[model samples]
Target chain A: MLTVNNLHASVDGKAILRGINLKVNPGEIHAIMGPNGSGKSTLANVLAGRDNYEVTSGEVVFQDQNLLEMEPEIRAREGVFLAFQYPVEIPGVSNLYLLKAAINSVKKHRGEEELDAMTFLKLIKEKAALVEMKQEFLYRSVNEGFSGGEKKRNEILQMALLEPHLSILDETDSGLDIDALKIVAHGVNTLRNESRSMLVVTHYQRLLDYIVPDYVHVLAHGKIIRSGDKSLALELEAKGYGWIEDHASAA
Target chain B: MAGLKIMQVQPDTMLASGTQFYLDQFEQISDKLPGQNVDWLQSSRNNNLARFGKNGFPTQKDEDWRYTPLKPVTGKAFNLKSAPTSGVEHEDTRSQSALRPIPGLNCHRLVFVDGFPEMSMSDIAGLDGKVSVRSLSEVLAEDPETIRDLLDSVVGESSHGFAALNGALHQDGLVVMLEEGAILSMPLEVVYASNQELTLVQPRNLICLGKGAKAQIIERTVSLSDSSCLHNSVTEVILNEGSELDYYLIQDQSRSSYQVCGVWARQKESSRFSCHTVTFGGGLVRNDLRSEMTGPGAHCDMLGVYSLSAKQHVDNHTTMIHGAAHCTSNELYKGVLDQRSRSVFHGRIKVEKDAQKTDARQSNNTLLLSRDAEIDTKPQLEIYADDVKCSHGATIGQLDETSMFYLRSRGIDPDVARSMLTYAFVNDVLGQIKIEPLRDYLEKALGEQLIREKKLFGQTK
Candidate 1:
């Protein structure tokens, strides 16, 4: 469903991603494990077309279309989702209002009829239940004064509502408690389908325990040094990234 | 006559041509002004006319008037005639449409055409005994002594050119007087519609609320003609002990119109006063709002919101005075400017030496949508008392980049995102309005304005 070939990106003349590459087919989950400053989040942001993350020389294809050439909103309308590590706090735009506008925008781009108020309410209620979010939260400002766990859950709620084809989870488990981590993992597990793909970027192995991935790639020094199955994550957790770094350097 | 003689003696080159024109026109209309036989009223007019002539409209050299220039107002020799011009006769259909009542608001409405109260268009049937609502000209003709003590008391010995001009040239306005313990259930809606081009309309409103009285007023100024006009208005309010008043001024005029408005209020012990000024359409607009808290336990709130586009310019100046102990005041003003429009906000808070335990807070925030749009904000606080809490802050910026990206990343179009954030910036002040219908109307109007501004300046960004 997605392919990245020799993706070299920089920010403000500072190289962050250097000659990186990855591929994911339909219905497959890829877990990207890395140490600090390994360009994991940078890769996710670059894939999402965030400004300031300039793609120096690279090619990203999503469903046979060039993804890097599109605007951020166009990428989003084309079914590319990035769950931010830090959700923005918007004081006046309500969560429900944003959800409606987002859904309608994507639907309009896809030549589908917009959902009425009743249908939208019902659909949003079901999605909110899937993420275990309260009804009152949808009426409040987006992520303003929200707790860490609530913000993460709100992101997942949006993901469930948008139903994007390729979802890039950027450090989604950093600030969440164990209980919230379980709920987020459960929501992701429930949304897993034959046509959906996900790139789970995480630092610890705890999140991988709940939402197991089919492949685990170790990203060190802006490149994926090792590729293996779920067992690589367990090994990295047992023996920290130091062992992998030494082995890759010696190789 | 003495003031006219003094003005005539001054060299023609020494006085601005606009001020010279008004001075010449005042001589022809002074004898026909209302309250001609009343000594105090006539003396007050003469003194203010002299003051206006001496100042000749404030220049940018003045500290308070640094950001605002009166060239547009002073360049034209606007008509000073008290009577409505022939174009706006009683049967004029456009005047009626301009004076239409606010939808969903049930109240006693008084309409004014060219500064004169239109009795045929007003509806104040059930407000006779409970509340005294009369035309200022009628009151001045019948009994000038009734409002002598209240008129011009709030703006005492001021040197503001517009205020002085309004004091001297005001022909007709509204006078609302409430007795002790009286509660006005319905809001008083006053609509001032300008239908004459190149005409100067000065309206003076006097509101006196006795002890424990409560009232709400909605003052709206609109323009019916596309031609350039000038509207100079002054409203003075006196709130007795334990009284409460809510005043909302909505200025939506023609694109070629110039407006200068001032609202001065005085609050007694345990009284509460709140003023909401919402400005939308005008070529050059200036609003001066001042309130003095003279008694203990009194509270005041000054809230405002303005939206401007094109070459529109709006300036809002507010002053809060804490003259007694245990008083509190809060001020918040916000503006949205797009497409080379400009705005200014100057907030001044003063805590007198004897006014201990005073709590005052002020904030001004603005959003500029285009590259050329500009805003100048200044917060001045003079606290003489050591045992008081006063805080002031101001911010001028564009729509937040992170917030924009957040909205756009969720699939909202960039234009829609910009409009949403712009509306949200002003929603803080709109949410404080207690009247539902008025708030709803403003929200709808502001929404339409945002759409219009987007279409006009969407490509500039």
Candidate 2:
């Protein structure tokens, strides 16, 4: 579903992602774990085509199309979603309004009929319920004065509505408490399907407990040095990243 | 033309050519002006005309007029002429289109063509007997003493040259007077349409509400002529004790038109006054809003929103005076400038020494959509009372980058994203409008403006 070969990226003339390569097939869930400053979020942003992150030399192909050449909105319309670590607080644009516009844009790009107001409302309600979001939150400004849990849930609600082909969850559990973690994890687990692919980026292994992944890769110094099954996350949780750093240096 | 009187121009006063031209026009029309036979009215006009001749148009040197330049208005020559005795017999489609009534707004409608009240087009019947609505000319001809003190009472000895010009040369306007305890269930809609080339239209409106009375007034100024014209209007309001008034002014003129408007209101004890000013058009425009709280427990709110594009320029100056104890005032003005358009907002709040327990808050915010677009915002607060609570703030910025990106990242087109954020920036003030139909109309108009501006600039970022 996605391919990243020798992805070399930088920000402000400083190298962040150096010689990184990864591949994910259909229906596969890959968890990228790394310590602080290991370029986990940077990789997610690069895939989403954030303007600040400059791709020095690399190639990113999504569904056999070059993703790096597309604009951010084009990438989004092409079924690429990035759940930001910090959801922006937009004071005037209502959550429901943004969701509707987003869905229609993607649908229009796919040559599908736009959803009517009634149908859009029904779909948004169902998605909000999946993330345990109240109906009132959808009418309010997007993430303005929202609690940490509500913002994370809003992101998931958007994800469920968009139903993107490649969903990159970047530190989705950073500010969420245990209960919120369960809710978000449950929403993701419910959305799992045979044709969907997800790249879960996290510094802690607690999020994986709820939404287990098919593969776990340890990213160190801008490169994935280790790949294993679910057991690898458990090992990293038990033994700190120090052991992995030492092992990578020895190897 | 048979009754024309040529008065001598004063040579002692040094005036700019623009000022001399207006002074000469006023001399020619003074004899035919309404209430010319009344001693007090004539004397007030003479005094204000003298003041205007001395100062000419306000220069940038004046403290209150620092951010606005008057060259565009002064450099052009506008003839001062009286309105035709009767309404236009032929229906001019341009002026007719400008006078189209707002849908779903049921109210007392009054239309003015080139500063003259159009009785044929007005609908003020079925009004409560206690409430009197008539044209200023009619009142002046019948009994000028009735409105002698109310006219120019709120704006006494005004410093603004435009206000003085309006005081001296105002041809015709609307006068609404309500008796004690009388309430107006429907809003009063006043539409002023300017449709003559190089003509000067000055309208003076007086609204007096007695004790315990309540009323809502909406004033709209529109331009129907393709040629450039000058529209100078002044509205004075007097609210008695416990009376409440809501006044809205919407200025949407032609791109080549020049407009200057001033609204001065005085509130008695326990009275409430609110004014909303929305400006969308005009080549050069200036709006001065002043409210004085004269009695205790009185409250005043001033809210304004302006959207300027192209080379259009707009200046909004507001003053809130807390003269009595226990009075509160709030002011909020926002603007969106795109392309080379410019906007200025100056808000001042004053709490007198005897006015204790006064609460006043003022804020001005502007959003610049292009590098060439500029805004000058200033919020001033003068609290003479030690126990008063007063705050003022101003902010000028571009479209927030993060907000723009967030919207675009969700598949919204960049143009749509920019427009959405721009609308959001001014939506707060728009939401405060209580009239649903008016607010809806403004929203649609402003939405179209945003889209049109986007197309004109084509991706400013």
Candidate 3:
């Protein structure tokens, strides 16, 4: 469902993602584990078409279309979702309103009739209960004063509502407590199916225990250095990126 | 014809002749318009009229009249004849003065169309106190004693040319005399409408809130013209000792209708005054609101919001005075400008020399939607009291790009995202308005206008 070839991107004349190549099929959950400044989040943001990251040279094909040419919102409509590293606080805008707008935009893009208020309310009621989000939360202005944990849960709820074809969870596990991590992971895992794939980007191996990715790729110096099954996550958790740095210097 | 000219002319204009108009109108009540017995009410009104005739209106040279030239105000000749619904039927009068009255509000509603009341449609249903609303001519035909006195007590004729013209051509207004401890349950609705035939007409309104008396008022002025017309009105609000007054003004006209309105309020010891104005229309609009905290413990809050599009212009000039010790004042004004529209906000707060412990603050903010649109906001604070707290702020900007991008990334159309942010920017002022229906109505109207005029950039491709 997702493929990257020679993905060379830069921001402000500084090269970030250099000659990256990767491929993923449906029903596959991939984890890109990297150290600080290893360009993990940048790869996530670049894939989401963040304008800050200039695609200096690369070819990224998603669902057989020129992924790099579409605008961020268009990419979102075409089923690419990025759970932000830091959820933005938008005051005076209800969380429910934003989620509903997001859902309808994708639905409209797919040539589907928009849901009315009653149906939308029912949709929220059923989806929100799965993550244990309180019904009263819908009345609040979107993420205005939400706690760290609540904001992440709200992000996952949006992920559930939109049901994007490709979900990229960037640093979603950073601010969550044990309970919140489990809830967020449960939300992500429930949405995973044969048609949808997730690229879970995290530094800590604790989250991998919950989400359990099918493949793990160790990213260092803006490029993937190693690819293996889930056992690679545990190996990196024990040995750290130091092993890769030593091996690269030796080679 | 100068504002200062009225200052030297008829200080007792309301005293000597105006009350006589009301006296004859209510001939049975010989001394004053009789209802709730307030002994000194007649004397006060008489003295006020005397001062009004002596002071007259101001000229262009005055500090307040510097930016706004009043040559167009005084030159117009309008007859101050109070004609009730004498010639027309009650249905015709009420239908002609078509203002929807709020339910459960039982206060007296005065109607002034083209400077005269359609007496047939006047509703003074349950008025039974020293407070009675009457047209200047009607009061003259019935009772003139009270009307003669209180005409020009607070705003001297010499300070404003329009006020002097209004005073010189004065005919009607609301008269409230609280006998020490009267509490009114409803707001007094003052409805003034103008017809094209009236040309440049001036309508004057005077409201007196006696000591310990409380009331709320909604003054509405609209033009009945699809062509050009002028509505120059002066409304005086007097809050006596321990009194509280809440006033709201809705100035929604047309691009061809021009208006110059002034609202002056006087607050005595321990009195509180608040004024909320929503301006959404008019070709050129000017609002001058002045409040004086005359006694200790007096406080006043002035708030206003205006949304402009096309070539419409709305200007607000507010003056708040902390005259006595322990007084406080606050002023806030917000505007949203689109297209080639323009807005100006001038807020001035003065703390008198002897008014120690005065706390005053003023702020003005505006949103400019287009590069061609403009907003000039200036907040001024004048302090003579050494021991006082005063602050002022002003800001002008457009929708934030980062916030807009965030909302758009969340799947909200860029236009809808902008609408949300614009609404939030004005929420500060809208939240201050306590009236639920009017607040919601204004918010919705503003939202619709924003969406209609909102130009989303870089979306076509």
Winning model by DockQ: 2
CAPRI quality level assigned to candidate 1 from its DockQ score: medium
Best-to-worst ranking by TM-score? 2, 1, 3
Provide the lowest-lDDT 10-residue window in model 1 chain A: A45-54
Model 2, A53-143: lDDT tens digits are 9999989999999999998899999998999999999998888889999999999999999999999999999999999999999999999
Is 1 or 3 the stronger prediction by TM-score?
1
Residue ranges of candidate 1 with Cα displaced over 4 Å: B1-16, B36-39, B86-100, B119-121, B455-461
lDDT of each: 0.89, 0.89, 0.74
lDDT at residue B207 of model 1 (Cα atoms): 95
RMSD to native, candidate 1: 5.4
TM-score, candidate number 2: 0.94
* DockQ for each model: 0.67, 0.68, 0.38
Q: Rank the candidates by lDDT, best first.
A: 1, 2, 3
TM-score of each: 0.93, 0.94, 0.80
Candidate 3 local lDDT, A65-172, one digit each (tens): 999998778888899999988888776677787878888988898899998999999999888987779988887877778899988988888888888889999999
**Which consecutive 10 residues in model 2 chain B have the weakest lDDT in total?**
B7-16
